[model samples]
Target: MTAKQDAQLTGVPSAAMTSLLPGPLVDDAWLAEHLDDPRLVVLDATALLPSPRHDGDHRSASGRPGWAERHLPGSRHADLTSDFSDPGAPCHFAVPTPEALSAALARLGVGEGSEVVAYDTGGGIWAARLWWMLRAISVPAAVLDGGLAAWQAAGRPLASGDTHPEPAVTPAVPVLRPRLWSGIEAVAAISRGEHPGVLVCALPPGGYDGSAPTRYSRRGHIPGSRSLPGRGLLDDTGRLLPRAELAARVGAVLGTADSPVVLYCGGGISAAGTALALTVLGRRDVSVYDGSLEEWSGDPARPLETGG
Candidate 1:
């Protein structure tokens, strides 16, 4: 057999390792310990969310200003609203194309061989979004377990001002993985029972029940979806729950269905938390609805359901 065939027999690579990550989740202690690793590129992917309102769609702001004011000592800001999203897409936070993804990573000093750690100020929701993006492309990355608050609580040092590094010597080449993302058509199919899988809404319970205010014109979840709020997946400390506890919660909602899971949120940001949680539980049959409620609600013809 050829060398390629022989190498393929085992999942291990024949060459020396090019990149490494501490899995999809890492606590503040792990980050503090490896703060100085040359191959590590830490990012603050915080997005300032608007306070909950009883009336209408809430506005969100880029967390760059806050990130610029203070961030992890060696970290830089990753503007998820602009740089990491598709500017031309009508819906906000639209996933970027492979080229845009590559350019953004390259500009951020992330090469094919780079290891990444992502965190946010409020919770790890925003950080989980970035981690999901990197993982979808097979880039080694992890979400800081408890985020900036945890780091600060642990008395870690922080820095202010611009810390943007030089462009990566080797630009990132996105190798898109299969079934990591699902489009509107597939989601619509699922809603119509033309498809077989689980539709999980990862927003707060309000979003699932249609009682919550929404940025989109209409509130409520897509038809036949189950609630699995991403916020519920985390503990009071913002770290993930124990694996057994997590599995129990997830399994309870999923309920013995071996079908693939399709996760979605108001825009698309919070769903990553559920995706990350599922990944931590050793699930690979998952996909994120890129359009999510933004796109689904944009079209009035689509049906929605009120209440859980």
Candidate 2:
């Protein structure tokens, strides 16, 4: 076969990736080039919940004012409180059930086989959470490599006016593989180092220590866990570093796929970001400690260990 045909047959794209990001996850340029691809569905997940901190957030709890000011020409907003959240779940940004998630995606004009790209302005925390939700539902999706900042830096076109997408034809409930999830019980076991695994602390140094994180009621991480701040994975430009650098940095903390790697942050949001990084690095067996330190430290029985 010709080189191009060979590459395509092998599931690798013909050209070298312009950015360090994987082909499945596009950068600003790639997204700009494919703006009219018809297959792309971009979602803007850029709002804080309607809590005391809501108004302080740029999105103002209802809509992302920044997105209103300017956004990717075809992007639709994903309301955190209304669209992609589980009201019943005790934790913040918990994964909604399949039915709830399916309905939410349908409203956002996402359907089966849609190439969904999610983004947030800040570090990829919000975008990564939604991307994990999509994967949980068996939808083909990914996050924008560096989010809105990168997009605007590349001089991409922006549009005004609220673009309401037509409702999608809801497909059958996807047959999801119940993996990549760890509950409080599993986190407890990790705290005791019962299973003997790697625990990633994606929080700031102070939060990773015994000091209570501002976001969570309790602070500190599971016993025997290592403090590998999620920011270490990002570059000076706020983009994920090159794969080789990421591999090197993560190699010490993360072993083989067979070796279980449990990740957690204040309330499991940043952990999802780490999980996505691990996924891009081709570690398939990784799972997020969903309850994270929030649930683990809630109980007095669980021992808390501070310091890196």
Each prediction's total of clashing residue pairs, residues at least 3 apart in sequence or on different chains, is 0, 0
| lDDT assessment of candidate 1 | 0.82
Pairs that collide in candidate 2 are none
Regions more than 4 Å wrong, model 1: 1-18, 52-58
Which pairs clash in model 1? none
Error of 1 at 96 (Å): 0.9
Q: How does each model score on TM-score?
A: 0.92, 0.84
On TM-score, the leading prediction is 1
RMSD of 1: 3.4
Q: Following a full C-alpha superposition, what root-mean-square deviation does model 2 have from the true structure?
A: 5.5
Mind giving the per-residue lDDT tens digits that candidate 1 earns over 197-286?
A: 889999898888988788787889999899999989889988889999999999999988999899999877889889989988877688
Tens-digit lDDT string for candidate 2 (1-308)? 66533322222244542222233356887777776766677888776532223211212254466677778887888876666878798765667778888888878877765667888876776777777777766565678888888987887777876756586667537646466677777766766767756677887677678554345454566777777778778887667879999888888665553667778886566777777777777676667776676566667887777666
Q: Candidate 2 at 177: error in angstroms?
A: 2.2
TM-score of 1: 0.92
Which 10-residue span in candidate 1 carries the lowest summed lDDT? 4-13
